[model samples]
Target chain A: MARIVVDPVTRIEGHLRIEATVEDGVITDAYSAGTMVRGFEKILKGRDPRDAWAFTERACGVCTTVHALASVRTVEDALGISVPRNAELIRNLMFCTQMVQDHVVHFYHLHALDWVDVVSCLSADPKETSRIAKSISPWPKTSPAYFAAVQNRLKTFVESGQLGIFANGYWGHPAYKLPAEVNLLAVAHYLEALEWQKELVKIHAIFGGKNPHPNYLVGGVPCSINTEEVGTINTERLNHVGSLINEAITFVEQVYIPDLLAVAPFYLDWASVGGGLPNYLCYGDLPTKSYAEIDSFKFPRGAILDRNLAEVHEVNGRDAEEIKEYVAHSWYRYERGDEAGLHPWDGETEFDYTGPKPPYEQLDVEGKYSWLKTPRWKDHPMEVGPLSRMLVAYASGHTDVQELVNETLGRLDAPVTALFSTLGRTAARGLETKLVVHWMKEFYDALIANVKAGQTRTFNDEKWDPSTWPATAEGVGMTEAPRGALAHWIRISGGKIDNYQLVVPTTWNGSPRDAKGRRSAFEASLIGTPVANIDQPLEILRTIHSFDPCIACAVHLYDPDGKHVHQVNVC
Target chain B: MTRESGTTIIGIGNLLMGDEGVGVHVIRHLERTAPPPPGTEYLDGGTGGLHLLEPLQARTRTVIIDATADGRPPGTVRRLTPRFSSDYPATLTAHDIGLKDLLDAAYILGDPPDVTLFAVSITLPSKLGTELSDPIAAVVPGMAERVLNELD
Candidate 1:
C-alpha cells in the first residue's frame, strides 16, 4: 500500500491533514488529523456564562454566528428560559441566511474548483458560454459581450503567469470533466457569487449588529425594534432586509441551484463515491413556529443507523447517555484512560503532545493520530451534515424535503440509496438551500406580521439576570449549523461557567478512531475512493470538501503564550 | 467586472492570540489617533481569507496590517508591497486567509490591487489570552503613526 498525504488541505477553513493508504489505485485505509488545538472551552471556565458567546464565536470567523447562537442558547437553556417568539423568528432568519450564504460560497468557490477546471475556461468560446448560461437560468448577465469581457480578464490573468489562489491547483488533471464553455460559465458565476455573498452578510449585520461576530445576548437577540428611534429595526431597514432576502432567493433559485443541477449530470459517477458510515445525526433547527414547541422545528432532530431510513432513532443531545466523546486515538489525556468515552460535561482538554514529532512521513495511526476527538452518538460514529439532515427530514415525512429529494433523485435517474454518496451530499446542500430560501420568506412574513400586531418584543428579560439561578445548572444547546449538528454543553455554578464543551459538526465528521478502532467519517469515506494519481489526489479533495470540513471549529484551541509549540508544517 | 475603486486599510489577525493581533492594534491606534485620507476605508479584517477579495477587488490600492513571525525580534515592523506570491512571508497564522493565497488569487484573476503589507514581527503565542505582550504592545503607537504617514 502506497501512503499519500495531503497536509494542510487548502480551500477549506482551518488546518487539516489527510493521509490515505492506496493499493492498486483504490484507497484501502485513510486517516484524518486536525493539527490545531482550540482550548476555548478551557478559557470559558470561571468566566461568567453570559460572556461565553464572545469567545466561542471566535472559534471560527467564517461560521461566527452559529457558535454565538449556540453559546447563548446553552446559557438560556441552563437558565430554563424560552426566548420571546419574535426573537426566535429573527434568530431563525439569521441562521437561514447564514446557511444560504455559506452553502453558496462552499459550492461555487471552495468545492467547484475541485470539479471545474479554471484553466480549461481559456479555450471556451464566450458566445457559447453565454448561451449555455442563459439556457440554465435567466440571470440576465448572459450577454455575449459580458462573457467576452470575463474571458478576456481570465486570459489576461492566465497570461500574466501569476495564478494567485489559482496557483498550485491541479488545473489540467485528468479528473476534470466539465467542457471549456461550461467551465467558463461556472467561473463567471464563481465571480458573481463573491458579490452575492457580500450582500447576504448585510442581513446579519442589520439584525445581529455586525457581520463576522454578531452581537448576541443570552436572553434574546440584541436588536431593538422602535420605528421612532435610530439604530433600531425600523420600517426602512426592515424593507431593505426584505429586498435583500428576495435578491438572495432569486439568485439561489436561478443561479446556485440550477448551476448545481447543470454541473451534476457530468459527474454522475460521483454519486457512488465517498459513502462512509451510514449512521447520521441532525439537531433540528429553524423552528417553523415557536422555540417553546420542539415539534415545530423544520429540520427535525434524529439519528439514522446503518443507512436505515426505515428506522430513524431519536437523539436527545442533552442526554449524556446518547452522546459521548472518546479521545482514544486523539492528542488528549483522559483520567479514565484513553479508551474511555466521556460525556461532554466530563470532557477533558489536557494537551499531551505524544505523537511523533513533525517532518515525519506518516502519523502514528496505531496510537494518537488527530487533534479531533471521536464523538459518538450511542457509541456510533454518526455522520452529521447536509446528507444526514436531508435523510432524517425525509424519513420524518417532511413532505417538502421529501419532494425535493425525490425530484432531484428522479431527475438524475438514480436510486434513493444514491443519496449516500459524495454527489448526493453536494446535491443535498443545494436542495437544503432551496428549502431555506422558501423558509426565509416565511420567517420574514411572520416578522412583519408580528410588527403589525404590535408584538415588537424581541428580548426575553425574564432570564436576563443570573442571580435567580440555582447553585448548579447544566444544559445542552443543540442546532443544525449549515455544516451539520452542533451542540454546546455548559454547566454554571455560582453564576459562573464551571465546565463547557462543544461537539461541533466537524468534530463529529472529522474525528479520530475510538477505543473500538472505528474509522472517522472522513477516514471511512476515503477508504474506497480510487486515487487517479498519488501526486494529484483530487478525488480525495472532492469527497472531503463535499462534507465542508472546518477543522478550526472542530478542534477547540487557544495559542499558548511565550512558547512556540509547533514548527509550522506546510503541504 | 471591475470593483468599486477606493483605498481600504485592513488589519488581519486573530485578536484572541495576544501578539498575533498586532495588525488590529495598529488599526485601533489609527482609529483613535490619526484619521485617514478622505474616501480611504479602514476595516478590521479579523483573520479573513477569500472574503478579503471583496475589499481587495475593485480597489485602487489596499494596505494590510498583520503580525508575522519570521525569526525577527518582537516589535520589529517592515513595510513592503508584495508583487508576487514569492514576495509574501513563508507562513501566516491566519489559517483561512493566507495572505499569499489571497494575493495570488487576485493576481491570477488579473485585477490585483496594489498591496502594501505592514508585517509586524512577533513570536508565536501558544496560549489563549487577550492582552498583547510587552514588546508588541509598545510598538502599537509607532505602527499606527507609520500607517498614517503612508496614507499621506
Candidate 2:
C-alpha cells in the first residue's frame, strides 16, 4: 500500500489536508483533516445574544451571509420574535441571491479547473469552439472572433511565464477528459462567470449595508422599505434589484446551465464514483410564507437513510435526540467522555490538542487527528449539500425539483441511481441555481406587492428590549447554505449568551471518524476512486472539491489575549 | 469596456484577527480624518476576493491597503506597484482568493485597474482579537496619510 497526501488543497476556501492510502491505483482508505481552528463559538460566550450575528458572520468570507442569517434566526427563535412579511420576503431574496451566486462561482472558478485543461485549450480551434458554444445555448458571446480573442488572451497569459492562479494546475494530466474544443469553451465561460458573479451580490448591498458580512437585526432586516425616501429600499434601488435579478437568471440559464450540460456527458463515469454515505440530510430553507410554516419551505426539509428514496424522514432541529456532535477522533475533549455525543445546546469547545506538532511527517490516525468534530443525524454519518437537498426534495414529491431532476437524468441518459455520485452533486448545484433564480423573481414580486399595498413593516420591535425576556431560553435556527445543512444553536440567560454552537455544512461533510469507526462523506467518497498518477492526484481533488469544503467555518479558535497557536508554513 | 476615471481606495483585511485587520483600520482612519477627493471612493474589502473585481475594473486606479508578513519589523509600511501576482509579498492574510489571484483574474478579464498596493508588515497573529497590536496601531495615522498621498 502506498500513502498519498495532498496538504493545503488548492482552490478551497480554507486549509484542508487529505491523506489517502492507494492500492494498485485505487484508493482504499482516506483521512480528512481541517488544519486551522477558529474559536468563534468561544468568543460568543458572555456576549449579548442580539449581537452574536455580527461576530459569527465573520466565520467565513466566502459564504458571507449564511452565518448571519442562521445567527439572527437562532436569537429570534429564542426570543419568540416574529418578523413581518416584508422582512421574510427580503431575507428570502438575499438567501436565494447567495445560493445563485455561490453555486455559479463554485462551478466556474473553484471546481471547473479539475475537469478543464487550460493548456489543452491553446491547441483548440477557435472556430470549432465557437461552433460548439453556439450549439449549446444562445448566450450571444459565441462568435468565432470572440473565441479567437479569448484564446489569444489566454495564450498571452500562459506565455508570460506568470500563470498566477493557474500556476499549480495539472494541465496535461491524463485524468482530464474534456475535448480541446469543449475545454476552450469552458475557459471562455470561466472568465465570463468571474465578471458576472460580482454583480449579483449588489442585491445584498442594497438591502443590507454591504456584501461580505452584511448587516442583520434580531427582529427583522436592518433596511426598511420606503419607496419615497432616499436612504432605504427606495424605488430606484428596487428597480436596480429587478434588473440584476433578470440578468442573474439569464446568465445562469444561458451560460452556466448550458456549460454544465456540455461538460457533464464526457465524465458520466463519475456518476458512480464518490457517492459517499448511504444517508443524506437537509434542513430546508427559503420560506414561502413564514418560518413557522415548515411545509411552506421551497427546498423541503428531510433526511434519507440507506439510500432509500422511497421514504423521507422529517428533521427537527430542537430535538436533542436527532442531531448530536461527537469528538471522539477530534482535538477537543468533552466533559463527559470523549466517546459521548452532545447536542448543540450542550456542545463544548474545550481545546486539547493531542496530534503531532508541526514539521511532522504524518498524523497518527489511530489517535485524534482533525480539528473538525464529527456531526451525525440520529447516529448516522449522513451526507449533506446539493445532492442531499435534491434527493430529499425529489423524494418529497416537490414537483419542480422532481421534474428538473428527471429531465436532467433523461438528458444524461443515466439512471436515477446516478444521483449518488460526484457528477450528480455538481449537477444538483446547477439545477438548484436554476430553481433559486426563479424563486428570486417570485420573492421580488412579493416584496414589491407588499410595498404597493402600503404594508412596509420590516422590523418587529415588540420584544426588542431585553427586559421582556423569560430569564432563560434556548433555540435553534436552521438554514440551507449553498454548502448544505447549516444551523446555529443558542442558549440565553440574563439576556446574554450562555452557550452557543454552530454546526456548519463543512463540519458535517469534512469531519473525522466517529466512535463507531464510521467515515464521513469526504473519506467515504474517495474509497474507490482511481488515481492515474500518485504524484499528481487530480482525482482526489475532483471528489473533494465536489463537496466544496470550507474548513474555516468548520474549525474555529478565538483567544483574544491567550497564547499563540501553532504556526503553519505554506510553500 | 468604459472605465471611469477615478481612484478607488480599498482596504482588505479581517476585522476579527488583531493586526490582520490593519487595512480596514487604516481605511476607517482615512475616512474620518481626510476629506474625500473627487471621484475617489473608499471600500472596506473584508478579506479580498473576486467580488472586488467589478469595482476595481470600474475605476481607473486602485490603491489597495493590506497587511503583509514578509519578515519585516512590525508596523513597517511599503508601497509597491505590482503588475503581476509574482510581484506580491510572500504572505497576505488568509483570504478565500488571495489579493494576487484576484489581480490576476482581473487582468485576464481585461480592463484591470492600475493597482498600487500598500503592504503593512506585521507578525501573523495566532489568536483572534478585534484590536490591532500597539506597534501596528501606532502607524495607522501614517498609513492613512501615505494612502491619501496615493489618491492625490
Best by lDDT: 2
Interface DockQ of candidate 2: 0.43
Give the interface-residue alpha carbon RMSD of model 2.
5.5
Best by DockQ: 2
Model 1 segments beyond 4 Å from truth? A556-571, B1-7, B28-42, B52-61, B83-86, B90-94, B97-114
- Give interface RMSD for all predictions: 4.9, 5.5
**Could you list the CA RMSD of all candidates, in the order they appear?**
3.5, 3.3
Best by TM-score: 2
Tens digits of per-residue lDDT for model 2 on A186-248?
A: 999999988888889888889988866688998899998889999988999999999999999
Q: Which residue pairs in candidate 2 have backbone atoms (N, alpha carbon, C) closer than 3 angstroms, thus clashing?
A: A37-A556, A37-A557, A38-A555, A38-A556, A38-A557, A39-A556, A39-A557, A39-A558
Model 1 lDDT per residue over A1-571, tens place: 6778787677777778888888888989888998767666777899999899988877776778888888989988899988888899899988998899889989987899998999999899999998898888988899989888888887887787766656547899998999999999999888788767877787887998765567898888999887667789999889988999999889999999889999999999999999999899998888877665667899988989998888878888678788999988888998888878888988888877788866577788888888888999988999999999999999998999999999989988999988899998999999999999889999999999989888998887886777788999998888888889898999999999999999899999998888898887999999899988887888989999999988777763232211222112223
The residue ranges of model 2 lying beyond 4 angstroms of the native Cα positions read A556-571
lDDT values for all models: 0.82, 0.87
Docking quality (DockQ) of candidate 1? 0.34
State TM-scores per candidate: 0.94, 0.96
CAPRI quality band, candidate 2: acceptable
